[model samples]
Target chain A: MVYAYLSILGMALILGVMGHRHTEVNHATVLHRAWRQLAPLLIRLPIALIAASFVGELIPQALFGEWLGERSGLSGVVLASVLGGILPGGPTVTFPLILVLERAGVGIPQLIALLTGWSCFAVHRVLAYELPTLGWSFVWRRWLVSMILGPLSGALAIAWL
Target chain B: MTVFFLLLGAAAGALLAERQGLEAVTGALLSAGELIALVIPLVIIAIVMAAYAQALLPREIVERWLGRDAGWRGLFIAIGAGAVTPGGPFMAFPLVVGLRAVGASLPICITYLTAWSVLGIQRILIWELPFFGVDFVVLRLVISLPLPLIAGITAQWLGEPGRH
Candidate 1:
């Protein structure tokens, strides 16, 4: 990370010295850009939680916990992936869910797949931005790759670990 | 449209989860809870990040590295770049779209977006290791190692727009 930062610094210096007046350049613009980028998530996450909390309050928590936990078979793996797509949250959000899934008997392999899906694809993203910008072809390309790789990764891990 | 589908899908998953077992229900709720838990923190982070993204990392930087001239090196760059590139991985979709609009290749864009979320530096160092342990994290990194390559190659192999 430090190396990356240094590299960025070096690049900035070079850009500065070369005296290339990039009218495109504005330090303030980037800061604002980052915020503009993240604003939706700020709203979306909490709403998702309120809905989820309802499920937590009403749903049969302990019963399903046993089912999804390690004891589950291949079904667990498939279930894990599907569930992953449903929950869209950050790392702090993902970890606790993983722990809970483990306690609920979600197999390790399936858990990995869930994380893979969580990490890779958000259905919301595909619609909100991916398809329009990158094209369905590009979007689908990773989805197909992930479908194969994600499960394979989990399967391999469970086998060895 | 996508949000509609996600909500619909979640609802369906909920039904299926309900039927699966007691455990599935709990797992689902936990999934839901994670989202709820993230509200405050992710929002704060998002606000800060959005502001930052607006200021730093010009459109040209994204275009230059992930652009037409980028070639194969761009593939690898896409993966590592994901972590550093700001936004919720989902939210980053828009930025990726913007990049493509500016001329990033489809393959590089796809791979980069995936790498952004899966291998993001923040998630890797801050969240994943602490939660899953070093071994699990190592395994994850190892597994994720080749993903961008696969995604990029797949996109490239499939050919350009209008081919399909």
Candidate 2:
């Protein structure tokens, strides 16, 4: 967590320098663009955090503790991967939900699997973006290759650790 | 739309906490405050990093290094560049298509997309670190390091229709 904060500070410093340079060249266009993107995150994230906190409080931790724990093992990985692919929304929603699960005792392997699945094989991204832009063939080929990635990663983590 | 749902969930959460009792309310608020504190700065920095990354790479450079015959060197280059390139599918997919048109191989293309998805530096610094912490992030990255290259090799061996 300290590393995260320090890294952010470092990035902010770089952004400051970069933003100033870009301002001289582009008259603050890039700065404005970055802010336009960040504004939504600033507003939505706090609300999501609040909801996620309550969700942590409300959901019985025993449920996740069992379902996503080491006891669940390979099956847990499969389930987490499948869940990750189906999860809706962007980072705000996904991260907070992950937070809830993590606090509720979902292990690192399962979380890793979840994130892998979300990134590599989320059906939403395929349908909404990849299919339309990259076409069916590219999507199909990639999707086929990706089907095992999440579970594979999870299993690997388990074996390695 | 997501924001709308978040608002609704927040409202429901607050109400549910109220019903649960003062202790629940206090607990939720404290945790939420802590998370918000942790997340906000990270989000701000991440947004800036994404913008910077978007500006850093030139399309020409990406195209030159990721061509069909570039081999393992091409694969490594694709992974590094893809990991750092910011924005969503809107930016990435089109860039991949453009690269493919200019003689980038199917395997390299697959490698690029997979690397971007799995190891996206911007997303990790912003979301994963803040939410999952450094430990989980590090482990995931370590385990994931081999995947894009593996996928690329697999694609090469398969030699599908899109092959050059």
Candidate with best TM-score: 2
Q: In candidate 1, which residue ranges exceed 4 Å CA deviation?
A: A1-67, A73-75, A85-103, B1-54, B89-91, B98-104, B122-139
Taking the tens digit of each residue's C-alpha lDDT, what string does model 1 give over A59-146? 4666675555565655666667677866764554456446545544456667777888777667765676666666676766667666
User: What local lDDT does model 2 show for residue B86?
Assistant: 84
TM-score of each: 0.62, 0.91
RMSD of each: 8.0, 2.6
Model 1, span B1-164: residue lDDT tens: 23643484467456656667657656656666564553344334434434344344555566667766677888887777775665454546666766666666768776887787677755554345434556666677777777767777777766655321
**Pairs in steric clash, model 2:** none
True interface contacts retained by model 1: 0.32
A58 Cα displacement, candidate 2 (Å): 2.2
Supply candidate 1's per-residue lDDT for B71: 76
Encode model 2's per-residue lDDT on A1-161: one tens digit a residue.
Answer: 99988986787677667655763434255567678889987778888888888877887888888999767899999999999988876777788888888888988889889988888886767788777767877777787788788999999999978
